[model samples]
Target: MKTRIKFSKEGNLRFVGHLDMMRYFQKANRRAELPVAYSEGFHPHQIMSFAAPLGMGLEGKAEYFDLRITEEGAATLHSAEAAERLNREMAEGIRILSFLRLPDDSPNCMSIVHAADYEILFRAVAPEDKIAGQFVDGSAYRSLTGDEERSLRAAVDELLQRKEIPVQKTGKKGNLRELDLRPMIHALRCEDNRLRCTVAQGSEANLKPELLLSALFSLDTARPFAAMPRRVVRTELYDSAGKTLESYGTIF
Candidate 1:
């Protein structure tokens, strides 16, 4: 039988990378003595997969993983009990939220994942309040006075309309490639000192939340605020049709 686990990453633990988290989970599973299945052949390994890998230094309230279990007795263990047991043994920043049984025919987490919602917070070095007030107050600032802001808005709008927004591909023999960011960006808006964005996921078209922020910063000459922390929080996960497949509360 297959099981889906939902969890949260927060606090200082946000610095943990995906691969390290995987290894941690494998160790926890072993410690918990969960009857997780092993792969066939000589190099047999845990049958586990993550829905989406969160970037380093970002936090997530909703993260998911799927695992196969072998023993029917183990399958009968209550998911809630397993979650509680895991949390007791887990480190401070990582918490297992919930676990549920999944249909054997359900699609893999990687393939089914399509979108992610994130909240980004940062302090602007420029006179953000003054500039934002002008835009919100409906008093048109002189074109020359707010040229940087105007230019930034124009760039964002143009990028939104484009069929593809090319981003530099890393870790490849060819360092540069055009990635279709249009399909990835479902929504992007700024509010309350934060930029909220929902973007497509998976191999098809992936957008790094940091890249969006970088693009905005690149448009203006003002330096970002010193000693102002930038934080990212992933709020939710969705499927291709924009349906919530699993939530943080229900993720183990």
Candidate 2:
């Protein structure tokens, strides 16, 4: 039986790298005594594959991984039971939100993930640094006291109106290349020091929240983005056509 595990990562565990998290779950599965399938080799490893890996220091509510178990194991280890057992074995920062049994012919989660939603909570800039008089909608400005929020909202609106926003990102091989982020950003909103955005993810194209912030604020020239985004949480995942895949709130 093939199954997909939806989980969440928060707290100090956000600092854990993808490889470390993978290892942590491997150990958790062993300690939980799950009947996980193994590869046939001198150094056997569990047959499991994770979806898009979360960046270090970023939290995710919809992380996923697929694993295989024998039919007998499936009967004994139901989805809810599996989640319960794993929760007991998992550390404080990680939680198994749900376990969904997939059809034998279903594609792996990693191949299907084409986009993801993220919510970033940031600290508002001080009044002295506000771009208050910039936006087109100035009628509602006097009533608002948070200069940072207004400035950020205006910036987001401007970014959304652009034809193309090019951003430079360092690739895995250490080469930096310029890529247009406008097409990658499917949806974006900034309000009250929080940014709710959805961008392309997975093997083909991925856009990190920090990259978007860097583009919006010009982190290189303007003040660094050190004060904002106190927390970032990935809220959901989707396929190419915007079809909702397994989510954190999903129940088996």
Candidate 3:
């Protein structure tokens, strides 16, 4: 049988790389005494896979991974109880959110990821000086004059109306190429000193929230948001039909 585990990474742990994260979970599974399956062969490895690994330095509100349970008593483990046992093994910055059974015919979590929602809060809020931190820019960061708020709002509006928003990407061999990010952005709104955005996510095409903000900042040079600190939190991930990964299975 297979199980999907939902968890969140925050605080200092956000710096943990994907490979390290896998090792951490493997150890956690053993510490929790779960019936985790192992690959067959000369060197056995845990049968675990993550769904759309988050980028380093960013926080995630909802994240998921799947595992194979092969022990004889695995079927008897209650979903909630499994989450509880796993929670005990998590470090301070990571938390187990849910455990659910995936249908036999269900697709891999990583493959079906189509879109993502994010909330950004910049560390700096003052109109004149930079307050560095993590987040998306909006009027909500700090007390902004009516004019400053309007300026930020106007920047976002102008960006969305453009035919293409281009950014440079480095190829595997270190070649730089310009990529357009406009179409990948499904939606964006700046209000309450925060920026809420939805963008294409997954293997096909991805648009980073930072690129969107940088584009907006470039449009209006009055406020230097590009140099300010950035803080981003991915709120949730969705499938092509607009459903969260959690919706595909039931949580106990």
Candidate 4:
């Protein structure tokens, strides 16, 4: 039997890398004494897989992982009980949100995740500055102002009017290429001090919020978000058609 776990990453745990989180879960599972299955080999490993791995320094309220367990164990281990047990074992910054038993034929969580919603909170630059029109470069590090708020709003409006927003992407071999982000951005909204965006996620055409912000600000695409101070939180995940994705238990 396979079980899907929904969890949240918060506080200092946002700084933990994907690999570290994997290892942490391994230890937590062991500590919780869940009857998890292990692969057959000299170097046995747990049969577990995570959905989308959240980027470092980015928090998430809806993260998922699937683990296989013995049928006998699954019968006895209720989902709610399992969640409670895991919560007790989880570290300070991580919390278990839900535990669900998936059907035998259900697809892997990672493959189903086509998009993700993110809330980006940061201090924008004052729009009154001469560089506000440019909207990029070193001017973003400054504080926000009423005039700048209107300027940023206008920028967002202009960005949405265009059919294609081209940005540069660097390949592994250091080659730079142009990529259009307009198609990937499913939705976007600029509010008082936050930018809410939903963009293409998963293996195909992933668009990071920082990348979108960089493009929106007309910054240099080759590391435009390097020094930006911001807090990113993933609020939801969705399918390719822009529908909210539900775990195994919520499928009904």
The numbered model that scores best in TM-score is 3
Expressed as tens digits, the lDDT of each residue in 1-252 for candidate 4 is 877888989777888999999999999999999999999989999999988989988889888888898777877888778999999998776889888878888787888889999986653544553232211122232334566456667777778889999999898899999999999988887775567888999998799887888888773322333455667889888767665545455411
Better of 1 and 2 by lDDT: 2
Question: Candidate 1: which stretches are off by over 4 Å?
Answer: 123-167, 221-228, 247-252
Best by lDDT: 3
State the lDDT of candidate 1 residue by residue for 1-252, as single tens digits: 778887888877888899999999999998887888999998999999998999998889888998887867464677878887778779876788777777767887878888899976542335443332221113322222355445444555655666766566564686766555566788876545455789877777668887766554544332332234456788788887776656322322
Model 2 agreement with the true structure over 1-252: per-residue lDDT tens digits: 788898988777888999988899999999988999988989989999998899988888888999887677877777788899999998776889888888767888889989999987643345553332321112111122365556667777888899999977888899998999999899998754467899999889889888887787763222334444356789888988887566322333
- RMSD (Å) per prediction: 7.4, 7.0, 3.7, 6.3
lDDT head-to-head 1 vs 4, winner: 4
- Stretches of model 2 off by over 4 angstroms after superposition: 123-145, 219-226, 247-252
Error of 1 at 155 (Å): 8.1
Of 2 and 3, the candidate ranking higher by TM-score: 3
Tell me the RMSD of model 1 versus the true structure: 7.4
Which 10-residue span in candidate 4 carries the lowest summed lDDT? Answer: 130-139
TM-score to true structure, per model: 0.77, 0.85, 0.89, 0.84
Kindly give the stretch of ten consecutive residues in candidate 3 with the minimal lDDT sum: 131-140
Candidate 3 local lDDT, 96-197, one digit each (tens): 999988887888899999999998776644557443333322323344346766777787888888898888888899999999989899999887666789
* 1 against 3, candidate with superior TM-score: 3
Displacement of residue 214 (Cα, Å) in model 3 is 2.2
